[model samples]
Target: MEPAEMTSLRAALAESDFAKPPRINLRGEPIPDGLTTAVVYQGHEVVTDGSKPLRGLDRVIGGS
Candidate 1:
């Protein structure tokens, strides 16, 4: 992620209700059964595993 994008994301996350440390399981190691890439925002969990692709990233970063 770019520096400016990261900064924007940080700002947005700060306004959310239940933000957590985002994780990306892109490595080869075993990530447990249910572990996957995710972002928590406003008490909602958005997950992106192999079965589904991540979406609305631009919106997440305060972009159109």
Candidate 2:
């Protein structure tokens, strides 16, 4: 994919809401500090535990 296309894909994906990932507590549970934390995006629990971003907005949304 072209550089521009790739960039767009990442943005959309980043904005998407998702379900709770592994080792996550959504019941007002408190998580320890710096304990191999997971990445939370738009109320979505990303199991990848990474906030580096996955895909661009357009591509992630299956547009271009």
Assess the local accuracy of residue 21 in candidate 1 as a C-alpha lDDT between 0 and 100.
Answer: 30
Per-residue lDDT for 58 in model 2? 21
Task: Give the 10-residue window scoring lowest on summed lDDT in candidate 2.
Answer: 49-58
lDDT of 1 by residue, 1-64 (tens): 8999779787655654323433442445555684555666656665544343334442453353
TM-score: model 1 vs. ground truth: 0.34
Measured by TM-score, the strongest candidate is 1
Per-candidate RMSD, Å: 8.3, 9.5
Task: Kindly list the per-residue Cα lDDT of model 2 for residues 42-62, writing each as its tens digit.
Answer: 565443323334333223433
